[model samples]
Target chain A: MAAIRPGALDPARPLAAVPPGDPGDPGLAESVARCLNDFFTARRGAADPTDPRFDGEVVARLERFTLLGGKRIRPTFAWWGWRAGGGPGSGPGAAAALRAVSALELIQSCALIQDDVMDGSPTRRGQPALHREYAEAHRSGSLRGSPRRYGESVAVLAGDLALAWADDMLDDALDGTDRRARVRAPWRAMRTEMIAGQFLDLHAQAQADVSEPTALRVARLKTAAYSVERPLEFGAALAGAGSGAVAALRSYGSDVGTAYQLRDDLLGVYGDPAATGKPIGDDIREGKPTLLLAIGLRRARERGDPAAADTLRGAVGDPGLTDADVRAVGALLDDLAARSAVEAHMRALLDSGLAHLAGAPFAATARDALTALAGHAVARLR
Target chain B: MAAIRPGALDPARPLAAVPPGDPGDPGLAESVARCLNDFFTARRGAADPTDPRFDGEVVARLERFTLLGGKRIRPTFAWWGWRAGGGPGSGPGAAAALRAVSALELIQSCALIQDDVMDGSPTRRGQPALHREYAEAHRSGSLRGSPRRYGESVAVLAGDLALAWADDMLDDALDGTDRRARVRAPWRAMRTEMIAGQFLDLHAQAQADVSEPTALRVARLKTAAYSVERPLEFGAALAGAGSGAVAALRSYGSDVGTAYQLRDDLLGVYGDPAATGKPIGDDIREGKPTLLLAIGLRRARERGDPAAADTLRGAVGDPGLTDADVRAVGALLDDLAARSAVEAHMRALLDSGLAHLAGAPFAATARDALTALAGHAVARLR
Candidate 1:
């Protein structure tokens, strides 16, 4: 949490990246990875044999999924957030901060696993999703019953365990800190908000919502606040950030987070599978009721192109969609300029978020790192 | 947690009830209800409109499910365990103690919601289960997509929230206490054990497991300890119970807990729907791979009753099983003496559990209350 002083990270430099290997950020990422490695190693060995409840396979699967390469965006953002609150950038206290921030990854694991199951996603991070892996095992004759159901049950339990274990990990970070309640307050809020947001997203899909506001709200709740804002708050709270700083982070984080989700929505429609680790048009097939679809639909009908609108509608949620069908839908959206419209929207939001950091009382390194993170959040093609 | 003492609730008493309206237990129940009522009321008001994330329906559904009639067995046992550790039976401290104990209900709520969804259970407590209610809503036109999928998604989020919220509630109980870590140690263990047990049970079903030891292991994980033993530990820890007291309570609780599940499995087959608030032969319909079924199958084969064993197997896990099918299986099981055999096993477990409590270091009134609870656990029709 930092004061939202009016000025930009460089009002002239619109989300420009500094190439790869940014100095401190890479170390931050490495620290989080190391923390996760240790956590999993400890867990893998701690499986009790006397207690049949401690299944070896569950531990292995969980470890595999956790290490399957996420961008570690949350922890990166949290590190800067803590630094913004005057936490140590490196040295003795940094490990504890890093450990605390890594918890977001565990929580993310929970969300991703459950979300994949809910979406019926076949793959994640370019590999079979957790449920699909389990289903495959069942199909391989290792188990009975409906393979799909067994797979899903396993996924659900795995996700629940991740959430519980996330708290346990956070406990390690907060131990003897005398700030457990303070730190836990935001962490608890973040958990509830994420779940609620997920429910909303599901409800929107269920009701086939087309309202842009509703979709934006869903994105903000499910992605923006949960992915960006809350992680920032968690780190801030961990640093005992003051109310002023917390409010600044709230405004700056939400705006940037909104930009992040807007970019994600675009990626769902246009990003390459290799880069995104998801199939093109999968969201369309799932009828996600995302902002992109909402904008495309509304704009097409507004232009008196009923047939174009029809073509877009035809591909919105067609599970049987062919590659050709997806391209045609993509072409129509391109024709409507909907993609650029969203891109412009995202750019403006990101710029506005960066503008808030002007004159803020942050260490120079934190400011530079946050600026870099802002670039990644907004401009990353992946 | 309590030490495993060697005495009985009274082996010769035959589960004799102490009449209706037992003195202190009803008050304990009321106190828990009051805590839950307040928690829900606050949650209901906190649903912010600006955030589409929070849904009125979600909160209402969770509240309805939580309050809809559970035996509150865990909280009661926990309270006694606490009393056995010198926690007050009544007064101001009782409220805080009760709050901690009642968190178990929230955990139970999570387990029930997810379990129902996983089992595709149509009803719970003689009412439509959570997923069923949501699916029915979809069928009635308020939502779209696969009704079952939407319903399950909602139930999963609901359950996840219950767990997260349970921790939040526990935080309130442990607020400002120096003993937070001490109490949390057992709470964490209980949480992990119960989840592992659920997974084990699910795994058993998928494997079509028949080993009696494996079945018992699953029960111990899934039901006995979660429902009885850990709750006692939670209460004892809250009361600062010594290791000896904790160990004694653990023994008394687990044995009684084991009997509780054994009786439950029998009731699933033979208990009246009116009394149990569940349909008869439900376990068979769901293919739960219960201990009773394992015993029946093994005994039928051993007794040169392959035909009876076949008949029982035919009924096992038949989702479309008819009343006639259930009756035929029941008859075969009766012929194989599996039902009586399980009843005998349950009685033996109960007697042994009561035996442990005889020398437990509990106050006289706590002893009386626990004795009554033990009777209720094993012999109650429901």
Candidate 2:
């Protein structure tokens, strides 16, 4: 498949082109780009011609999605974690370690593809999401079958394939150790936690009685583990970082991960649709049982407004809901202070995560990178 | 879900449990059992509580199928390949390597699950196949969707999950190696080849001009790469086997894999329904573009008996095909010498595989295992 060069909207610019401090300094951004390129090239080579294995549409979506310009926070986290744990910035081993970080980005892509399908999302990074793209392809007679189901099935298979590729990439990343069991622990944990968390998220959506605490718990397990703890700890573990360092990184990761999801909850409601690349009031339309939603429900129940309860319940997932209805629901959410509560939660989590990072044995550069990641993960209303 | 134990099938007498080096080698049997238990126990633990994962069905089937038995050729091949490449049998690494071999069983299960779904097969191992079982479940309940589609979807998901897990297991196996790139090469190649082969098979079936040679090529690429060459080479690679050893093993694996599929083709036509756990003439009913089918078509064309061709085409995949139609098709297949030709192919492959194994560095005991596997793969008539 031909590569989809990132358009002007690509996230790679901010993340992939960070300026080096000096000629003598290692260009981390360049390293990340090279690592990503190599990983993707390997993946393409892995495509067997005998299999009607490659769907051009799916491939285009993945290339576009993966190449989207965001700060390579996860990969940077992995790199920094390794560096902090006494791994050097050069040599074959270090290069492999960095490639391992690149693998995390691919895994992230897999997650987003499946998550978009499950959420019935329409847009990603200012473009129609994978399923939407495939659906359009079907509409245009570019492919045949039940478009919606085809989109879902293809996305599912693509995600599965990507997930497998990530492991293969990681297998190419670890070097110079007999610590196979120890190194495998975090990868295994990451996969297990992510899947478990996804199930919890699904279950929470299905059940009507989800509480704030329950929702938060799901977020921590599902989002936090993969987004922060596992990636950091996996890199750290691979570098033979001691248990103490791993424990500290875990604490830091968990806090940042929780805050990350809380910020996402806030964005799901009030963030600008243009910037977020999703429809305004999408979460409400989808009836996502987020922290904000739980908060709104609790407040409405306390006020004993049965009418408010009916309105909220009826409006959730009602795609035909009027803009006025959307505004009204947004007003109710704000009035209930749900948005403020989420902001406060985010602040607490950021503070806790940063505090945990204090006194860790990581290099100053890595510490800075982690702080930058936390800041970006919860960046304000934009 | 509660553990679904295998029904009364004695593990010791399983179809594939040909004990080597004295049937009285209780120690070896104990070691094998211990290895199997530890392998599965760890696999079960690998499931995360958060993911609504595949309900341990892969592991469950692995346990049931491996325990119910056929000749344990693949695992033995893997173990011997490792040992022949200079890996010692006493260390923790050895155990890990053995566990890796056991994972091939899961991969095989995955292949079988997907193949059965593709074939629209109703039974496996004297019971309703997974898809059929799920379909039956939906029928017996007040399910709210298309039961067949749901069954297919679930089975597809299950197979996908198993495939993902297989890579995960292999990744775990290759951890802490400096030869990460080398170790991962075969895995990456295997995945690509298998998926490509599947596509080729599908494409061949859909086309009217598929030939015997083309169909055979598809089988070899799709089934052979993973089943024989990849598994053996993956183990050998991990044990630091030289390129020569890897090449030799590949040659051996290719021949054996081709023979294995040839035997499968024969069984699909002529095997007893009770023994095969499928309805008689399943391949005929499915219109599988097998080598046998292609040959039969050619023979019928030469004889100018368009009636046989018409009957064969009409009956293939026709759910309403009668016993008489099945008999006619079977007779036609035999008249074309399809059965005998396939049997000859199997014999040639076995001979070639064993010949390739000759003068290799494998242990005498391991060589015996390989020979046994070759025999067992083609032992149906016996």
Candidate 3:
């Protein structure tokens, strides 16, 4: 991937136009990128003057990894959330708000980097994962310890740095603002909930839990809270929104976030690989206890289809599953009407979330942006 | 390994007596322990009511691990540093100071737990390391996927939680205080420096660089800064000390902290295993590029003793080194006068640190306590 030129990422650039009706703010993306670049430049300068290797190994790579790719969806949502809470769109206050929301990307950076280590993913965003890159460096340098261990250790430290930096950024953004207390609550909650949700996700997989409630809980905590609800609440809180507005945004975020994950669950099985940039059926092969699989399994058992139930149980977690096996499972799910059920469930969630937004006392533009974002979230690849 | 009863730890208990002229404070230990227990209790209460497993797995284990065993050296130093900065020994402010200093233990928790994961150590503080405990649970439960991976992942999450909780504690302790900004700067710097130090350590190990400067740099960054200097600065900062006092305390901490590590290096090879609770000669076996080894190698070469130099190079870091090999290395080091040189260096560092303390304007009791602490640190196992 080509390196991003820091100079080109100007924070003062005009907001990019949203194409026709899709949810976007290219200007927000550029400004967040600029903010991250400036932060990293300062951090690099602050690195131990006695040890130049530190800047090279940790900070530079972190900057490159962060700048390389991400849709900046979290920041976008936060922006709309702030707007809905009556935050201005332009001014020093707006700039600070942008800085605060941009911090979400750093948090995202921490999550993805650490998750790659946990999952042993070799690549991210079409490039070598941070750990893998470090491991390769170790191997080339003839390091003494296990290369893999060194790589993972380095990656963990890198992730820790990112997490710490995210906090620093948020603190800087809230420096002179009276919203520190209000903003901090959700920020703290978001961090803990994300980790907790990750733990639960791991636990569910370990226990082979297929219950609908467990699946929904993981989705709500891991995806909804970290990806949507908390970000919305964080923005609303930063704007000093009243309780009713914060509550409405939170509820709306919860529904939309769950719906978004449900859509992802479907795409994991059936979306075009080229479009999704993920292998179709990989989730099934891993036997992830997604809501789709949970519902399908329940329906199969409830219908007294022993063959289908047995096949589903045997094939879901089989690492050696072939394309034929995935096709069979898909066929079984369709026959049980699990696909239709999940699709219908997803739509209902979206509708309910939109209704909450409709009744909320928010700026008209923010309301429209949020509606578009929610629709775009669930309607992807539809 | 007996579990500490929370009720038995009272923050308001009278200060325990110290051995004549020894740096000690049993009351401080009790207060810190009580503060931690109270924090954990509240955190447990705040765990999702819908997910008790999260509390059981993450928070409870972290609490048990933290409360189990530690000399609480960091907090002790921090307390003295605060006192030296004119902080009262008893009052609501003192209580807040205790709370803030207690945060160092949590940061230590993060470091140690993650260190074990990186080093692949199976035990710590006379108990199974956190990762090992979780790995065993996975093994016994016959969980899907790699038990080792799951355990490490869980440990990583637990460490992340500890890090976040430490920040929360510090923030709480500084709430509504004018010292928030002052305290935050060192707190932020400490966190980053610790992680940077860790990265540099791994880099040194990977490259097998045995230069004196590299070894000293690693010692200063990895141990001195995190274990001593930063904690002292954090306390002094929290007390809003003047630049001269903070600078004096920081300088004192630097010398004493490095001396402490040098002494530790000696103990790693020569101290009584029973007394230190560590295997003697393990450092040589692992070929750790300690200052002792660095000095020994340099002296051997300077003396034109090819045999001594070759043996030193070959025996150090040889995993399969026998007792005889260790004995030979020790004899050679003594022959080269490396041990005497390191001893003299350590004493000089301690004296220099104490002199800095003596010249600084500080409370009488605090100065005395710091002097004792410096002596205790470098004179260990003497």
Query: How well does chain B match by TM-score in each candidate?
Result: 0.91, 0.82, 0.90
Better of 2 and 3 by DockQ: 3
* lDDT tens per residue, model 1, A12-80: 222212223334444555667789889888766555642634556576677678775577777877777
Give the DockQ of candidate 3.
0.61
TM-score of 3: 0.91
Residues B96-207, candidate 2: write the lDDT tens digits. Answer: 7766666666566556666676656777777777778666655676453356755655555455556666766565555554445556667666665655555455444444
Query: Per DockQ, what order, best first?
Result: 3, 1, 2
Q: How do the residues A203-281 of candidate 2 rate in per-residue lDDT, one tens digit apiece? A: 4544443478877887788778877788888888878998888888889889888887877777666666666665667
Q: List the residue pairs that clash in candidate 3.
A: B287-B317
Superposition TM-score, candidate 2 onto the true structure: 0.79
lDDT score at residue A264, model 1, on the 0-100 scale: 77
lDDT of 3: 0.79
The better-scoring model by TM-score among 1 and 3 is 1
Q: In CAPRI terms, where does candidate 2 land?
A: acceptable
True contacts kept of each: 0.64, 0.23, 0.70
Q: Rank the candidates by lDDT, best first.
A: 3, 1, 2
| Better by DockQ, candidate 2 or 1 | 1
| Candidate 2: chain B TM-score against the reference chain B | 0.82
With candidate 1 superimposed using the best TM-score fit, by how many Å does residue B342's alpha carbon deviate from the native? 1.6
Tens digits of per-residue lDDT for model 1, B1-382:
2222223232222221221233454566566778888887776666554252355667778888887647677777777888888898677677788888888888889899999988888898889999988888888976668999999998998899888888878888778776578777677777777678878878777877766888788788777788888888888888998888888889988888888888778877776677677888888887776778899999988988778777777777778898667777777777788878887888777778878778778777777667667766555432
Give each candidate's interface RMSD in Å. 2.0, 4.9, 1.6
